[model samples]
Target: MRMMLKAVVLWGALAVAAGFASIGAVHAADKAGSKIEVQKSKSPTTQKAKARPVSKASSSQRVAQKGKVASRVSKAKSTRVAKASPSAARVGGSKSSRPTQKGKNVAPAMAGGVDLWQGQEHLAVRSGSALVIAQDGGEALYEKNARIVVPIASITKVMTAMVVLDSMPNLQAPITITDEDVDYLKGSRSRLQVGSVITREMALLLALMSSENRAANALGRHYPGGLPAFIVAMNRKAASLGMSRTHFADPTGLTSNNVSTAHDLARMVAAAYRYPLIREFSTTPGATAEVKGRELEYRNTNQLVKSPTWEIGLSKTGYIQEAGKCLVMQARVADRPVVIVLLDSSGKQTRIGDANRIKRWMESASASGKATPA
Candidate 1:
């Protein structure tokens, strides 16, 4: 009986110790579960930083971080796109569906393309207006304000010669210079004095070759119906030549009302080139006329006609304060017929320099296959 009671007490102590150890283990597991819950309750941004790539976030993360954080991320992305657009357009389109910024200006660049010969170096000229065109081809090789009309100065003489020849007037008839033939308006002097008598043909020759204002006036005065009638005829002839922009206020071009564009002057030069007498008389280097039994020599007004380098077919030069130095010509350049008109040239030698530069450019174009075929 004593042995049984001792064994029973020892068993009771062992059972109580086992129960306490189980309770302690249950409390440890509950505390561990509570720590996991605390970690899961963190803010979305912190969770996202820990869980996602720094460069990009998942849509779910963005939605999870709604309000201020999401708005900030969206705004930053839009700003980045806006800053990249211009550079992307310069390099090439960033997106294939989006139109490039540079695409709008492409057509104008092609339309006003650089000349075939003027690849890098543009031809520098001083004339206020100029035009260089192939005679038969109608190809404009060069142009500068060619359509703007201004006073044509004595380039009017070419038209005067054309009209005089058009009338088929009696070439050998005597014409007397009078006070009416004098340039009273401008006070411009003339070598042809009053009462000087010359044949109509000589007057025409002097008018064209020497740019003799009195000679031109005498020719106009001797017309079938006089100076006013002659002015009417001048306008009629200009209209006939398709020189729509040209207007002749007087036969001498002394009046600034005598306005014409380089484009119209080119047409006039082309028409003048057709008349054989005008061509011969205008290009004659020098001639002598007998006035009051005294012989006076009158040289051609154009200096280029005397130059060996020029193969000028028809040429004229004119100047006044209102109209700066002006020149027009029909010449064969690089074996091709071309018409050149230079107007309002300020420098004394700028017209000649421009002509030389044009010739050199044409020759260069021909050599390099840049010239348009005739």
Candidate 2:
């Protein structure tokens, strides 16, 4: 009881102090209105820890606890604010907005302000890795140990898609989702089921978009020359892409030896980008279909797809005990196309947060670009 009271008192003091925090001038003019006050934070803002006002179950508290909708007015205001235009973003705060041609209304945010990863260990920590985003041509953002070779888990599927697309392009080709396709792919979420009848194209969608191991395996099994031929082709495709550091032992990224550096993976993503189908599939979100009389639901593995600030063109997510959490993406930020690769992130959410951090860093750098005030 005393601790709670003290917490409440501290919260009040902080709130009062914030009102006089002397944040100087930060304002925003938006399409909706110009009343937004984006005060320049003197210190990194701490998120209000959401501790409900000491229980007692008020109507509002109940609603929030149950995850029920907040008041309609608040929700509408939030939605409108999130959809704020670039012009409005310029009204105040260091909010940086970039254009994106693909996803609707989402502005690509650059690695915050340029040297996002600078001074912050230029390489992955131990099992971790980072990239030096390139500005010219189609090469990696610079890398170290990126190609030292590690188990890639689902990162392997990008290569599988490349090989399968090379060998199998007929969308109308009928294929059955057999038990072999669904075998050994335990613990991973998938919509592919045994005995489901789907087109070859559908299998590819699941393999790449949904990371359905069963779908990937089924595609491999359905290869005209079977698994051996499929493996041979996958290797051949890697060599053809000039990915000397990569080797594929399976169609799915589940195997331990499915190794590739962030650099090689970047090359893989660039190659994948050439295929319009791959791009379409990689960026697809929340698609549905029926297989074998059962409803199949597919959702994008990347949550940033729903972000209002990202113009993600193509993306993939991978994870396994051996590979940790991995993500690779191509998105335009500050109108510059950048490919981001974060491998072996410690937590499931860290990779995504890292992307956001990088975006913020880039924006900060761009805002002050090579200029010293007189």
Candidate 3:
């Protein structure tokens, strides 16, 4: 009986111990699963530290993100290069650059002026009033404030020359520069003193080539009906030529009242180009004449006449306080005859710069087949 009881107690203890061992194993497995869950929760923060959403993205999405970043970097580099370019600097840095005229088929502005274009190329013209016309076809090439009247300064000498030549006066006739010919109104200096004697032809040459105020005044005084009649003839000639906006108060162009528009000046320039004497005298680079037994040297006021590159047929320059600097020219540009008129330039070199710009623009246009000769 004792043996039987001992056997049963031992079996019961063994069964209880087996049950406790199984429970311990299950508890260890549960602790491991909890640790795995905690590590999984920390993985998202580590992923964010590496790359915000890319680290979790698929391979294809990552490639697309890299491409977007490269594109942005390339665009930034291109922007820097464009800002540093010389052409861009010129367009942005020049003080005289201005926007194109509204509703005009013009190009963007360049240094020192507005860019004007009728076709592919643009010209930078600095004058306040400017015009360019084809001499043969009368086609307008470029225009800026061309119709507004402004003081013409010494350009009046061109009209004075025309009037004198029309009368067919004796070229060899001796004309005396009297006190009346002295510029009392403007007090302008003159190489021709009172009591000096020069032929009518010499006076006209001086007036045209050198813009001599005294010579121009003497031409008017020696006209057929004196100064009053000369004035009348000037107005009549202007009226006859359809120069409705042109007016002349003096032969010397010293008077501020003497004014004309760029349009009218183009007509005057085209008309003046017809006279062989006007073309010769106006384009003469320099000349020397004898007055009162003294030798006086004179040079052309328009410097382009002396430039070897310019095929100038006729040229004139004028300046006064009220009129500003002015230039008129009949020249062959880009193998075509054209008339250019510039007025009211702010600086001495502005008109010349504008002329060169126009020449370059025309040549460029002709090369590109954008300009056709008339």
Candidate 4:
């Protein structure tokens, strides 16, 4: 009986041991499944973290493109501004327009009549002293330092002729070119040789058309009180014409002391235009003179006078180192009578260019009914 009981106890202990081993295996499998799930969730988190760098790079590229676009837009705006401004337009006479190197700065005057203002595109002149006025009422249309004083080289001849005519001198009187008529100051060459003889009318014509210093000197020398009296008369005439800023030291205009403002020159031009003799002489494009039995052909000093495109009533050109190229004229432009004065120009062609620019600007302004100020 004892032996059978011991065997039963041993069998019971083996069955319990097997049941514990099975339970332990199930617990280990559950722990392994939980670890796998945690690893799977961590894989998605790592992928999301890797994708963030690419998103940041794309954002940086978008910002860079925006900056480039803004730069292009700014450049376009700058170009437009430059095109609309006249400050970029070249101004100065000679080969180019230069700003005033000497002289007091004067404020620009307002355009008062007919309002013919063409913006900077119309009146880029190199002359330091300039003016444009309507002949009908003497209204200033455009001006640049018009009130400033400056030397007017052969422009003195206009006043000299006026004084000669006002004195009622014989137009047919004989005027001889002598050593006294030679330009001693500026050493300017003259086509009329010493002892050349011509009628007073011819001398006047040569003086106005060819800008002959000798002819002008002869005219002044024969005046009522001689050359001294002639100079006094010129000042008197300028004063009478309200040319407050004008003065003349000689009729030849070789002296730098012969000075006048553009405004005063415009007035002088207007006064001279009324004289039939001056109008005829100054506007003559070409003429021939007999000097020592040789017929010498002389052309007008003003180039515009020879152009068929210009209907100049009165014209004069004057030049000296002190006084750059100078010109004054009364012309019919845009169907209106106008006076133009250019002074202290630097270039040989700048004055003519300025006149053409004014003409084109005036025509365009009249057509469009918009006048721009220079």
Candidate 5:
């Protein structure tokens, strides 16, 4: 797989020189988009990311088998990564250009308050953000702006969880941080600094629970075969997981180039829930733990963590100006498994509102289904 990824990188570079983006251009406007730790290739996680393409949905493949773009609106037309991204190369962009998935499921809006007043105000707000709901064999319920990739803030940790868990055989291994790990190319939020050594388990916890940028960087740099190899693995893992519509330019979401749509993230969340550790870490409301012999307390970012009604197994939240307030979760709605993704919300409350609306949508859908005859 590593050898195959190297070959693909070579091919992609050649393809790029020939006048097309091997991957979608990483936009320059969002600097905080590059901070997820589970993205670096050359390590075990990268290897996991490489195989992700194997499970791809044939109907949603935007790129041709020839590895070329088919249309401007669909398949992420061959836009130059350099031209499209004024944002300088981050961690994963230079690696394999593993195309992401396409074809998101979408739901239509019923008549507004005038129709029946399904308690819209109390259930959720009207933020108009894009949302995706997945349940029962990964079918989509509602989709908006599910295709226009944008910055994804700390939510990049979802990939971090996937890649790190799959690549590292020894989860208990300790990874040390360097000065470079904490420092940002642009500006990024971080409480950790150089010379801090923490176990892979702890690092994963810090990155997901506290949204620590330093923890994310250290994990990538410490990855075997170095940064380039780490990136290759992320792309590969994404491909194997059938997440062709998603791409990782950096380990951290601190770079503007880290873009994804709500539907793509839903695909990611569905996969992340498969991991027990990921499910626990993302949903834990608060953790009073020790790191590096120092007592450190951390809590889940999603405000709903304390709510008993969520019934969430996994959850994550993210934000960057370009990405807006973003969120995704695996939960039980209407007594069944369901995944939700909300992106580019107007404000903090919008994501919550989106969640409420989804719950209501599920209830309404279930009710409507019962009313109809087989």
Candidate 6:
């Protein structure tokens, strides 16, 4: 019986030990599950850290896009500024339009009704002084330094012709070119020899058409009171026409003292246009004068008078050391009668280029219906 009881105690001990082991295994399992849950919770933080580079890349892209947008906006503002500036308009909106060197004083003025074309397309004129006016209404289409007095060079021949025609001298009368007719100041060359004899009408034609300095001087010397009296008459005529800024020192225009403004010259051109002979003679393309039994060929000084594209009623060109490449004309451009005067052009072709530019600008304005009537 004692042996059976000991065996029972051993069996009881085994059961308790097995129960304790089961409790310990359950606690270990609970702790393992808690650790797994904690690991899962930390997984989101790890994912957020991995995603930082993507967020930074997105920020950089936004910054680059903003920079591009700002650059475009800045360019747009600059373009608007250029379009609004007058000096910029003169240069066709070029960055080099900023006034520099001799072009600094060439800013377009709004005087003399030029404001009529304000905000319209500006002309790119290379001449230092220029003027354009309508014949019908005497309205100024364009003006730059028009009132400023400057040397007119050989353009004085127009006034000389007018004075000679006013005297009603015999056109067929013989006028001999003498040594006194020679250009002393300018030493200019002429086809009319020292002893060459030509009719009064022929001399006038050569003087106006060919710009013969000797022929012009001869006409002055043969006047009623001599060359001095002829100069007085020129000044008197200028006063009558209200050319307040005009003065004539010589009839041949060889003297740089023969000065007149573009405004005064415009008036002189208009007056000359009224005379049928002045218009015919000045616009003659080419003529031959029988001088001393030799046929001497003479051509018009102004080339625009011969151009078929230009309906020039009158034209004259002048040049000297003081007066740089001057040209004046009354022509029909864009179907409007206009008087154009360009003076002090630096280049031989600059005056012609400025004329063509003015024509195109007027035509464009007319086509766009932006041009106003005079």
- The per-prediction CA RMSD against the true structure, in angstroms, equals 10.2, 31.1, 8.2, 7.9, 38.6, 7.5
The pairs that clash in candidate 1 are none
The Cα local distance difference test for each model comes to 0.79, 0.68, 0.82, 0.81, 0.65, 0.81
Q: Least lDDT summed over 10 consecutive residues: which range in candidate 5?
A: 112-121
Candidate 2 C-alpha lDDT tens digits along 133-243: 543343333343454566678878888888888875687797887766654644565566566788888878877787888888878888879988999998888888788
**Residues 1-374, model 5: lDDT tens digits:** 99999999999888876544423344322332443333343456666667666545453453454344345434343344422331221223442332211322223222211111122222343433456454433334455556676778778888977887888547688788887776446677555556667788888887777777788777777677776776677778778777777778767787767777666677778888888998888877877656567777788888887787778888888877777788888888766676777777776688887787777766675565521111
TM-score of candidate 6 to 2 decimals = 0.71
Return the top candidate by lDDT: 3
Worst 10 residues of 3 by lDDT: 103-112
- All candidates: TM-score: 0.69, 0.63, 0.70, 0.70, 0.63, 0.71
Backbone N/Cα/C clashes per model: 0, 27, 0, 15, 46, 0
Cα deviation of 248, candidate 1, in Å: 0.5
Q: Write the per-residue lDDT of candidate 6 for residues 162-266, one digit (tens) a residue.
A: 999999999999899999998777778888898998889999998888889998999999999999999999999999988999999999887889999988888
Report the lDDT tens digits of candidate 3 across residue range 266-323. Answer: 8888898999999999999999998778888999998899999899998888999899
Clashing residue pairs for model 3: none
Give candidate 5's TM-score.
Answer: 0.63
Clashes of 1: 0
Which ranges in model 3 have alpha carbons more than 4 Å from their true place?
Answer: 1-121
